[model samples]
Target chain A: MRYIATILLFALKYIALKLAFVPLAVILWLCWITAANYRKLSLAKSDVELDKIDQMLAGIKDKLPMDAKIGFRTNIDPGRRGVLYFKSTLILAPRILENNDRDTILLIEDPHLQPVLDKNYECLERGGNQELNYCLMRRRN
Target chain B: MLFFAMLACVLVLFAGTSLSLTKTCGLSGPLRFPVAFALVLVILSYGYYLGLLFQIQIGILLLSLGLPPILYLAFEKYKSRQLNLSFPKKIGSKNLAVLLAILVLTIRFNKYVYRWGDWDAWAIWNLHAKFLFYPEHWRNIFTASLAETHPDYPLMLPSLIALFWRGLGFVTPLVPVAIAHLVLLAIPVTVYLALKRAMHSFAALLSLLIFCVDTTFIHIGGSQYADTLVAFFVLMTFVLYQETKVSSNRRLVFVLGIVAGSTSWIKNEGMLFFLVFSFSFLCFHFKKPAVIFRYILGALIPFIIVIHFKLKLAPANDLIHGGREKDLLSLISDPNRYWLIIKHFTMTGITDYWIMLLLVMIVLINKMPVIRTLPFMAISLVLVGYILVYLTTPHDLDWHLGASVDRLFHHIYPAAVYLFLLKFSENREIRLWS
Candidate 1:
């Protein structure tokens, strides 16, 4: 009976020691769990968003000088406007973006929406898919 | 051509940093590469400042800077009449599985990486990089109209990205992406090797495992933010701090000072760390004036440059812009701010820094003697400094804490884990190998 009691005491100490590393074990396990999030990731839709910005820029590539500053105004909703604006800034990067200026490039979110061009503006081109509407302007003196 | 250009950049960087490591610090073979990788970018970033100061083209500046290191190596090779460092032309199969896993993750993560990076990356860091990439209107990048992009922030990340852009003669998304990937992988490997050197192999392995599963580390690392690099340097400092405690090689502590100062070049949080670390270091090492002098000597150049940038070039910080005494009194006197800070600290502590906290709790339960170390004191003081900032933050309490507290923790979590695990060695004693 005494011998069995000694074995029980040792088992308790061993179990406690093992329990000390339970957090570390859980940490290692967490990686496998978290890594599963990447499996659902895809490139199809996001790629189109960036490429649309590029496509819009491609139409005005020759007209805009390397160092010119062009204002950008987007009709996209406030919620998604930041996304559209930043993407456009990168696409036309090295060219500073000025909002609400006469020398401007306009991006209309919906294809149906035509940018309202005033007397000072003449359309350079509109080139983008149904997702984006891009327009370059030549100012009319 | 792209591959060759990138290879040339990496080779040039390796040539410079490897020679630097040979003189400044003694690290083992496997350990050398990660530190060298980090030091190269930092050197390039520092060089950017000098380039701007001299009004020289960045590409010319970098090549001239790199030339000296090559010349130094040539002299060394001539002096020794042989080469001691062997360049490995192939990745060994021993670490192939690990390499393959990292490669898979890199490719997978890039698929999700927005071509412009996440909001802060593009709106702030990479956007600033674009200005440097096209310097024709560089003055406009720092104008009040561009205030939302934080022109006051330090230039390490943007400058490093721009350096590559300047070198390659064109900007590509691949430069920043590759950098982010390498930094993510480097952080774990660096601390792992440092720990293993300190005779804590078990703790080192756990760090690798912990980061592998850390969603925040992976995400922020791939996001092109500087927080992970901040984390990387903090851990490196912690490892080196302990090295000075165990070894008679006092020069290691000097290198630690250099690494610590380099952190300030990365971001404002790094500046906070530099201040707290300076105080903690002095308090702990005050017994030896000689050691203090060595540390200060190392930190002096970086510290002066950052001060010049802050005072002369950069705008006032958002948190501390125009306040004299009223802002501090009101922000601190209000008790609700305290409650909000505590609430967020607890919540974020659980969610974001859980792994590090778990290590802390385990060490406490097992009663490890981690409290006496320099890293423990420095990091604790830095945490207090973070809380103090929260008290006086200008932004709304909820918004301020919600947006930043996690990234704040990211800056120090790995080092915190390293500190606790210093005593979590097999014998449960914080013994460092001499």
Candidate 2:
């Protein structure tokens, strides 16, 4: 009877480990796939709209004062506008922009925003292609 | 030099809080690092909150950090007493192997952090760090208009990051990245120490392996999500609460209260965890009013900061939003919501290594003995808290559960392991892994 009980216990352990490994294998696979994709997405900044803002900032950074308060105009959806601010902060050199800071460089992505920005700030310079595009403007002196 | 200065300030405060308690209570040597690190984190969180409130200068920070050790040393001098600061007795070869395994696991976890941190790291925590680093505009992060950042979330993670930046006198992505990775590395070490005390070497090592292998845990820890930090404190509170039951030391009990209470300052769920911890402790030790009171009193230290932040600085929490009654009623009435939550909860929990955890427990069950009361009660209460949060959530049940139920499970995973190992360690039938 003791031998039989040991056999049953061994069986139970085998089954439980077998079941557990199924999910464990799945989790490990899912982790690899998701991690790879996530890395790609994080590094794919050049393909994203944020990269254009970075380029625009790069081209116009030398022209702006070190402490210049910059403005941003973008076509990014309302949900994603924070990303615009975050990525732009990294590329804008010593100058920084908070939301709606008065008398600042307005970096524009959408052409529709260009006229809106043009009305508010003096258009400083416009360059870049549709794929990687931007314009820099400053509030009227 | 400035960076080291800020770090030293944190260490001094940690030593004052933890070394005092550890000395008073005779806590074990293995516990010293986890307790010290957790307390230092609490101090850093407190320092940041105070700095924001006072707009404190560099001199004030230096003074706050320096004064504690000076005062502590003087108090010890007056008493002519020395702390028991020796290391634990030498571990066997197997134990050393486990330590080496955990070190390798942490190194891999750091690489994972390098690859993909949570979306929130870039979008929220680091962004807030930017605001805090720019001392003049730090206040702007709390603006009502910037609703997407969830500014109402407690500032401990961001504030700590910003503190590092303040020392460097500039903000860099590296600041948050490094802080997140430090917290990540601390998690496994925290687990290993807690487990070594509570379980046999093999059981403890096996449990640590479970934690290390769980992709969600490794991912979130690396991602700089506040979840793992919350898990660390929750696990520590559980382990320490178990310690208090055995030793009944007032200072350790008081320190436990502070650690548990500080969880509220980490995340909104931390407040719920703090409540669960307190209620569980009170119920478990109904006759021991003195112990309960000491714990509650210590907790009030961090709880005060949490209340002040919520009431004064933070915007209203997004979870408690407009049309509350209707949302609550709809959530309560829907059977589908219950099914949906259960589905996601199981799927995520299983995928997160619940299956492995259970299988290991079952295999070791014959070798295990009866459980302790406090750890079991604590685990049950925390699990119950997770379900309660999911059931009454004001957000859409699917979206809420999908995004966070797994993380919530992950939060309790360490505590669950500690509880499981505590029970397994008591078995007379099993002495060691061999």
User: Which segments of candidate 2 are over 4 A away from where they belong?
Assistant: A1-73, A76-82, A85-141, B14-18, B74-95, B355-372, B376-378, B391-396, B428-434
For every candidate, what share of the true interface contacts is present?
Answer: 0.14, 0.03
lDDT of 2 by residue, B284-389 (tens): 7789888888898989999999999889888887777655766687677779877887798778767775743574456365644334466556666777777767
Q: Output the number of the TM-score-best candidate.
A: 1
- What tier of docking accuracy does candidate 2 attain? incorrect
lDDT string for model 1 (B1-434, tens) is 54354446557668757765655565545666766776677777888766765678655675676677777777778888985565443344434434444544454455555555667777777877877776555555665545656889888888888778777787666677666767777777777777777777667777667776777777777777888778888877776677677767677667778788989988899998988898889998899999999899888878888888888778888887766567788789998999999999999989877887777677666666567766777888898989988898877889989988888898998777667665676545433331
Give the whole-model CA lDDT for all candidates, comma-separated.
0.71, 0.69
Two-chain complex of model 1, DockQ on C-alpha atoms against the true structure? 0.09
Cα lDDT of model 2 by residue, A6-119, tens digit: 999997776565445444444455456445634554564514444455545566768876556666666656656566666665455235555554565555454534344357
lDDT comparing candidate 2 with the true structure: 0.69
Candidate 1 matches the true fold with a TM-score of 0.82
What's the distance in Å from true for residue B343, model 1? 2.2
